[model samples]
Target: MFHYTKLDIFCNDVKKFADADGYVPEAEDICQDFSYPDTQFKGLKNWTQHIQSSVHATRSAQQKLHAWQNRL
Candidate 1:
């Protein structure tokens, strides 16, 4: 499975989903390995649903928290 960090979340990019350590997985890998609960989508529809998900909001907040902490 591919691991990703908040920095990898790109709503407007074709090549999305990167590892926290900066490894960008291939599109095929992403399709085969990535799974979100109760949803099956592709393309812009997938991105749209993702940004609206609770998981996305939570992760985004966590990312912000980490950034704020680093600045301190």
Candidate 2:
């Protein structure tokens, strides 16, 4: 049986892999489109939120995948 400590390590490694595999420069492109001050701030804020959510999803997926790996 895999120990909880090993699972924790696996999760951390998986997060690194997911970040490398799933990262997209376009995901952070909104930071550069500062044409209008008000609108850009709002758009950037939304985009930043999206990036955060995506990263969280990727981390969750990594955790599940790692758990399956351990099961197998």
Candidate 3:
């Protein structure tokens, strides 16, 4: 009999349940041999999101500032 572990279950489930083209590489798979939870990558995701949001916010503020300057 084969010894399929818990991780094998998650990978199979994630792959199966994931939507078409929504394939997410398992973080655990990347860190080692698929041995961590999805939350382990949360900080990286959060950092990227923060940078993107900050850039967007800065651009919007700059646009408003420029418009105000033009009016002055």
Give lDDT tens digits, candidate 3, residues 37-61. 4554367665345335434444454
- Candidate 3 accuracy as lDDT: 0.38
lDDT tens digits by residue: candidate 1, 1-72: 233343344322322433334333433334334444334445755644544453454455456657776885
Residue 54 displacement (Å), model 2:
0.4
- Misplaced by over 4 Å in model 3 are 1-42
* TM-score versus the correct structure, for each prediction: 0.28, 0.43, 0.41
Q: What would the C-alpha RMSD of candidate 2 be, to one decimal place?
A: 11.1
| Number of clashing pairs per prediction, in order | 0, 0, 1
Error of 1 at 50 (Å): 10
List the candidates ranked by TM-score, beginning with the highest.
2, 3, 1
Top of the candidates by lDDT: 2
Model 2 lDDT per residue over 8-27, tens place: 44345333322223332224
Q: In model 2, which range of ten residues has the least summed lDDT? A: 17-26
If both were scored by lDDT, which would come out higher, candidate 1 or candidate 3? 1
Q: Against the correct fold, how does model 3 do in TM-score?
A: 0.41
